[model samples]
Target chain A: MSSPATQPDFGSARPGGRTARTRAAVRDATLAELAAHGYRGLTVDGVAERSGVHRTTVYRRWGGVDGLVVDALDLAGEDGWQPPDTGGFAGDCRALAAEVHRSFADPAQGAASAAVVAASFQSPRAAEALRGFYADRNARSEVIVSRAVDRGELPAGTDAAAVVRAVVAPLFHRLFITREPLDAGVAEQAAEAAVAAALAGVFQLPSGA
Target chain B: MSSPATQPDFGSARPGGRTARTRAAVRDATLAELAAHGYRGLTVDGVAERSGVHRTTVYRRWGGVDGLVVDALDLAGEDGWQPPDTGGFAGDCRALAAEVHRSFADPAQGAASAAVVAASFQSPRAAEALRGFYADRNARSEVIVSRAVDRGELPAGTDAAAVVRAVVAPLFHRLFITREPLDAGVAEQAAEAAVAAALAGVFQLPSGA
Candidate 1:
C-alpha cells in the first residue's frame, strides 16, 4: 500500500511486506468510508472495492464491518505513538491538550475520529477496540507524569493517567457530549486546570490503597 | 398521559392538562425507544404505537425520528432540573459530579442519554436540541459557582460555567470517549480535581475578556 500519509499527527499504519500492505490498505479504506459516510454506510464489498482487494478475500479476512473497525483500531494502537515532552509538567499538559484539540477538532482528522466514536456506540466490538486503543494511549502518556515526579514538579504518587484525563476531558466533553463551541482558550484552560489539580496532589492515590 | 413516572432521579414531565399529557406520553415513548433500540431503531410509527397517539398526529407533529428526538430533548429541557446545593462549594461539586454519574452511568437512564448524544452526531436538528439542552443545564449549574463566590469560598472572578464544565467533563470522557470503567472513586476524585483547580483560580477568566 502507498503510505498516503495524509495527516502527520495521528498515526498511520507503516508500509511493510505484502500482507502488511494488504492490512494497511483495508484499514485505510475503512477509515475513509467511516469519515465520508459514517458507520451505518460501511460494507465489506465497499471496503474491498475501495482497497482494490478481491471481494472474497475481504469478506473472508474481515468477516464484516464490525471486524473491519475492530482490526483498524487494533492496528492504530500498535503505531508507536507518544505524548509530547515539554520539560515542564504544565507545558507538557498544554501541549497534550492542544494536540487532542487538533486531532479531534481539526477538520481534516476530526470527522474520522468522530465516526469511529459513533461506530463504537453502534457495535460492542468497536467499543471494546476503542477501550483498548485508549488504554494503550493512557499508558504511553504516563511518562509525562513520571518525568514531573523525577524533577520534583509534582507529588510522588500522582495518578498519571488521571492527570492526562483531566487535561483532555473538557475538550472531549465540549466536542462530544455538550455539543458546545470550542475556542483557543478551551484547550489552555483545560490544561491549566489539570496542572493546578496535579500541583494540589488531587490525583495522588492513598498509600497502599 | 398517566405520568408513568418510572424514574425519579432524572426529571420527569410535570403534571399538567391534556395538551401536556399528550406531550408527556410522546416524550416518554421517544425516550423508551431510544433507551431500548437507540437512535437507529426509533421511528415515527414506533413512537406513535408506543405513545398511543395517532400515526398521523405523530407524523404531523414530529416529522420523523430525528424530530421525535429533538422534541423529546426540548421537552426535557423544559423540565425543572437543578444542580445540587450542599452548602460548601466542595460539597456541591461532589454532589454535582455524583449526580452526573447517577444520571449517565445508571442503567435505567444511561442508555437513553447515550442514545441522545449519539443521535446528535447523526442529525443536525438533534445536535441543535442537544446543544440547547446542555446550554440550559450549564446555565442552571452556574448557581453552584455563584453561591461559592457569594460565600467567598472561591474568587469573585471565577467562571461559573467553566467550573461546572470541569466538574463533569472527566466523567463524560471516561464514560463515552474512552469507554473506561467507572467506579466510586471516579466521581469523587473528579470532583476533588475540579475543586482543587477552582480553588487555585484556574477557571477565573480575564476581566472584560
Candidate 2:
C-alpha cells in the first residue's frame, strides 16, 4: 500500500534537522497554494518558489504536483488527531459532525482540505493517501461507538466504523459531491440522524466478516 | 446562474437532423474516451477525432473539454428519469439507494459518471451542471418520501429532500470520498439507516425556511 511519494526516503538527514524543516516548508507552501489557487493552480515550481526550496530539490523529492499533494495530505496524519470525546454518544456524534462543518467553514482549512479531496479524484497516490487517512480516523473513532455500547446508549455489536462513516457522510456529500451549501443546522441533523440510526441497530455488523 | 458550456445555444438545428446526430456522436465519443483514460486524458481534439466530427465544428460548438463534459452530463437530464415505485417506504428507499450503487457498478456508466464527477472539481461550470442535475433528481425523489407519509410509514412533515440525500449520501461518501469498497449490503444498509432516521423524525424541518 505504500507509494514512493507518500513514503519518501529522507536520506542522510536526522530528525528535527534539514529533512524535517524542508518537509514543513513544502507542506505549508502546498497548503497556501491550494488555498490561493486550488489544485488546478498548484505546481511543483510554485511550491518550490513559495517554500524557498531549490527547484531541483522539490522535483527530486516530490516528482510532481501529484506527489506534493499526496505528501501534504500524508502530513496531516502526523499530528495524531483524535475524534471528539463528549460524554454522551449523541453529543459525541454531534461534536464530530460539527468538526466536519468547521473545517470547511474555515477558509484556510476549507481550501486545503477541499483541494486535497479534488486532487484525489485525479491522482491514485492522493486517493490512496486519503483512504489511509480516513481508515486511521475510522479506527480511532470506533472507541466512541464502543463506549456507547458500554454505556447502553447503543446496542451491543454495532459496527463502529460504519457508524462513524454514517455520521459524517452526509456532510461530505454536501460539501464535495453535491456542492451544496452547509450550515450548523445541516451538521446537527447529520449527527442526530446518525444517532437515531445507531439506536435503531442500523449499524449492527453482519454475522461475520 | 447560467453558463455558456452548460446552457449551450443549439442554434437553428432541428431534432433528429445534422445537429442531433453530431451531438450524439460527440457525447458517445466523450464517454468512450473517459472510460479509457479518465478526466485528465480527455481533450477536444481526441473527442473530435474519435467522433468523426470536424475539428472546427467540435471546438466551435463545445468550446473545450470542460464544455464537452458538462454538456454530456446535461444530456443525462433529457431522459426524464424517475425514482423507483416500490409501494413500501422502506422498499422505495432501498431501491433509491440501490440505484446509486448500480450507476457506479455498471461498466459504461461507472467510468463516465466518475469522470464527470472528477471533471466537476476543476470546472465551476461542470459543478453547476452537477448541482442542477442532482437538484432535479432530489426534487423528483421527494415523491417517495411524500408517499411514505401518505402511507403512514413516516411521520407527516418529514423533510423529503433531506431524507433522500441521507439515503444516498453514505454510499457516495464510500464511493467517492473514502474511496472505500461498496457492495449490495452497503446499499441496503444506507437505505435502512435513512429510513430509521426518517421514521424517528430526525428529518423534520424547522418551522420556517
Candidate 3:
C-alpha cells in the first residue's frame, strides 16, 4: 500500500472517450456485483455480463477481478471528494463524521463497503486496494487537521491521519464490529470524542521519533 | 445478532469426557480450516477430514460450518480470560490494548480473526456469531471500567462498554482498515486516547438517554 503521506494522484478524470464511458460502466457493475456477491463470489464474467461490456474487454483491460474491485473502490471516492471543512475543527470533524455515517448507513453503499472489507481480509491484493483507497482518502483529508493546527486549535506535529482515524474508528467499530445502529447521536459523539482526544494531544507523535 | 449488553453464557467449559474431547478437536479443526481457506472456502467435509471425526458426527454436532466457526470462536476466550487490571484505569486500559494488539498481531490468531471478520461481512449467520463473540468479550471486560468508576477515577455515569470499545476501536481500524503496522507505540496511544476521552466524559450518554 502507498504511504498515507505520499499517495499518487488517484481518480483523475479521464478524457472524454468511449474508453472512459466503458470504464465508468464497468466500475458501477463491479460495485454492484461486489455488493450482491461479495469479493469471494464476484467473478470477471459476472461483472462483464452485468456491465454489458465484452468479457474479453474486461479481462484484458482490468486484468482480473481484483483490478476491477480496486477500480470500483477508486470510483467511489475518486470524484475529487474532499473531507468536510466547516471552519472550526470541531464542525469539520462533525461534518466528516456525518458523511461517513451516511455512507455506511446507506444500505447499498454499506453492502458494497462491507463486501470490500470482507474481501480484504481474505485476499492480500484486496487488502492493498483497500489500504490505498484509505491512504488516498486520508491524504485528501489531512488539510482539515492542518488548517486546525494553523489556527492554533491543535498542537503542532499532531498526526492528521490519527485524528481522522480517531473520529471514524468508533463508527466503524459499531458498524463492522458491534453491528450496532449508527444514528445521529453516534456520529455526533464520535466527532466529539475525537475533538476531545485531539485537544488533549492524544494524536501527537513523539518529537523526532 | 445478540445485543452487546445481553449475551448468552459463552465459552462455558465442559467436563472431561469423550464429548469434550470431540468438541475440542472439532474446534481446533475449525480454526485451522478458517485460517487456511477462510470462511467462504470452509466446508463440513474439510473439517471432518481434518479433525478425523466422522462426517456424520461432525454434521450432527456442529450443524454446519457457521456453527463450528462460532464454536471455535467460543473456545478461544472460554478460559475465563479477564482484562488486565493494575489498579489504575489507565493501567487497565493499557493492558486491554496490549492484549488486543497481541492477538491481532499474532500470525495464526490474527489470520483466524481476520477470517471470522471477513466471513461475518459475507454471511448473516457468521455476522451473528462474530457479534456474539465480541458482545461476550466486551461483557466480560466491562468490569475494568466499572472498577475505575467505583474508584472515583471517572464520573459515575461513564459508559463502561463505550469506554472498552474506545480502547479497541483504533487498533481494529488499523488492523482492518488502513492496514498500518500494529506496534507498541500504536497500542500505547490507543489506550492513552481512550483514557483521555473517557476522562473527558466523551463516553457519557446524555441524561435519561
Candidate with best lDDT: 1
lDDT of 1 by residue, A1-209 (tens): 11111112224656699998899889888888888888999998889999998989988998989999998888877665678888899988988877777676567467777788888888899888888877777778889999999999997988888998888889888988887877768989999999999899889977812
Number of backbone collisions per candidate: 0, 0, 0
DockQ winner between candidates 1 and 2: 1
Q: For model 3, what is the alpha-carbon lDDT of residue B201?
A: 91
lDDT of 2 at A128: 92
> Model 3 residue B125 lDDT?
84
List residue ranges in candidate 2 displaced over 4 A.
A1-18, B1-18
Candidate 2: Cα lDDT at B184: 86
TM-score of every model? 0.93, 0.89, 0.90
Top candidate when judged by TM-score against the true structure: 1
- Among all windows of 10 consecutive residues in model 2 chain B, the one with the lowest summed lDDT is B1-10
DockQ for candidate 1, C-alpha atoms: 0.78
CAPRI accuracy category, model 2: medium
Q: Which candidate leads in DockQ?
A: 1
True contacts kept of each: 0.86, 0.85, 0.74
Q: Rank order by DockQ, top first?
A: 1, 2, 3
Per-residue accuracy of model 2 over A87-136 as CA lDDT, tens digit each? 89999898888777876776766777787788788778888988887787
Question: Of 1 and 3, which scores higher on lDDT?
Answer: 1
Clashing pairs in 2: none
Pick by DockQ: 2 or 3, better one: 2
Q: What fraction of the real A-B contacts shows up in model 3?
A: 0.74
